[model samples]
Target: MGSTSKMKVLESLGPLLVACLGILGCTQAVTLEVKERNSTCIKAELSALLFITYTTFNSTSNVSTSLPDSTSVDAASSSCGAAGRPPWLVAVFGSGHALGLSFATNGSFYSVTNLTLQYNLSDTSLFPQSNGSGVVTVVSSSVGIWAPINTTYRCASPTTIRAGGAAVTFSAMRLEAYMPGNDLSPAESVCTADQTTTTAPPTTTTTAAPAPTPPGTPETGVFSVTNSSGTVCLLAKMGLQLNVSYVSQSQNKTVQELVNVNPNLTVTSGSCGGTTASLVLTQQTTTLNFTFSMNSTTSKYHLSGINLLANWSDMTAPFSASNTSLDYLRSTLGRSYMCNTEQTLLVVPAFSLNTFRLQVQPFGVTASQFAAAEECQLDQDQMLIPIIVGAALAGLVLIILIAYLIGRKRSHAGYQTI
Candidate 1:
């Protein structure tokens, strides 16, 4: 309690207090409302983290920030119009970012036609090649929301919007256009990522003993195929596993075998063409050939085909499969498709493959790097299940506590004096 000790303690606590305040100020909910002719037309509330990545001096740098962080939005800059101009709303933020949403209405229904985000890269440290600003068309000519006029749209999960090198991700968002009142109502149509699919618990069944463990840990690495100019045209990072079913000569029954495509497999041959790219992985007597194709119209690419050939000592002959007409992995240019859960693909009836922690970008990559990623449905489902379960468990606990209190009160009703 001495004066000197008190001063030292205060000094030590000052930094911690500042750090706590900084963390608290990092994120805040931003609400944008548009009014026309004294009637609120659009209302949106978003509370999410935003990240930016750009190239500077041939190297890519990333900046992470949350929306409405220390920046204010002017009410005068947010406007709505609908007369002959196909109902649109634009909100400008003090950070030199603008969000625009265009709406289209038929006689019965209204839909969002386009969503755009204009960002300014004025900070030289964050964006080295800082020009004035740039525009990223998030969704163009796509029906983002289609509901009856006055319903709200809600998406609780993270949604990624990508365009070329720039991308924006939004989470915990709620929006309403042509609102019935000034406030946002319950959402009528939910985003697919927010929907939950209830799967029945698995049933018990008698089974044989588990098979032996596969060769080694699932190998994970990046595989790329470069073009004639030595530019990487296809890049994929994944852990691969091959499953083969063959007749066991000793047992005279079909037996399942698992093989891990480890990092020891070398790239024996590969080629990148104008419309297609191929990579071949070879190890001992096993070979895997991956073929990818691009769709110019959509500016997207996919793993269109695959071929597998393997020679096992236990099998009578080499197993060969050439699945040319297939569409397994797909993503847009400058973006990758990521799936952390294991994904199974059947090349043939008896032969199948699995991919884990897979992320692939087929084209428009810079500095051998991966751009933004579109998570696979399985990954989204995995994320959603935990939230749903947690909510359910919390509700059950609340119900049990309420029931216990009611039961206790009822039991004490017969007691005269306590």
Candidate 2:
């Protein structure tokens, strides 16, 4: 009986000891490589991606159920702004948790449940700058299985990563084919999916089309970008193409480029009247140029210039940029910009949902169209009410005091004469 007991103890100890020894000996230290190229852009700022989301919250991390297959997707790289973050990173667009699986390509399953991910940047080894190399896509498979863990994310299809510290890692695990294009909600589009489905684009008038050039001078919008395939964004409605060029020359600012930075920027003509528009920026060695047009060929009119709309209620507008209380509310309560004021421009989609009046900066809009004057008139009135009341009270007191003093002096003089 003693010998049999000892044998059982040895068997259990042997596997445990081996695993411990392996762990200590393995000491796998992960290394990362950062490649910086002049291709990021010639401008001080360029749009690059940061998140490469794969899994999501409240969803399956099962490599098969979660990942999109090996296919291309017609995703909007950016929203409201051309340089927007990916979808998976935004909780409103997508987020949740699920189990994840890893597999090998050889129809073999290894360990399941060893990998985990967080949509938030966690490690430096994950997102490299705009090197155009680490374009990653999420996928799932059934064969070579690995472990999965729960995590959060913004968008599922994470692309165009910018300078980031946390890098995603898959340790010698192969992936399975996820369906290319699956019918998904806006949130699900962030995850990798088979890119086979074609969805209809939204019907909206946007300011991405090319402007009609006056026969006298052809002003083209130049975008001095680094490290990208030389392509252009055609404001199909605007019939304008923002040409991304490699400018060894100095940059120039066109009317359109000015409007992009400060949508209130304008030369003298056209304005942003719609909910959506595309703005491209370019700099020659010295000059910058931007052009305004509509989306696609559907846009026929070219913006002549921009007019500065008058700020009507300067006094009642935001005090000192914005109210700090509101900003704090947004930060702590997951709300919109708390610090925003009526005087500030509301370009984001959030403000569109609620009917609030705001004057577009005098930049990209016409003087007559964006007529919503500042609403600080009411605030100014409230401020003046107290002062007016105080002035009236002081005047009444002074009059009463003067009358009493005058009467007292007359009485004293009359008594003296008597």
The number of the candidate with the highest TM-score is 1
In model 1, the Cα lDDT at residue 192 comes to: 60
lDDT of model 2 at residue 111? 20
- Candidate 2 contains a number of clashing pairs equal to 111
- Mind sharing the TM-score for model 2? 0.20
Which residue ranges in model 1 land beyond 4 Å of their true spot?
Answer: 1-217, 246-255, 405-418
What's the TM-score of each model vs. the native? 0.45, 0.20
Candidates' lDDT values, in order? 0.64, 0.23
Clashing pairs for predicted structure model 1, backbone only: none
Lowest lDDT 10-residue stretch of candidate 1: 135-144
For residues 58-109, write the lDDT of model 1, one tens digit per residue: 5555555556644443455444543334456666654466666656443334
Q: RMSD in angstroms, all models?
A: 29.4, 24.0
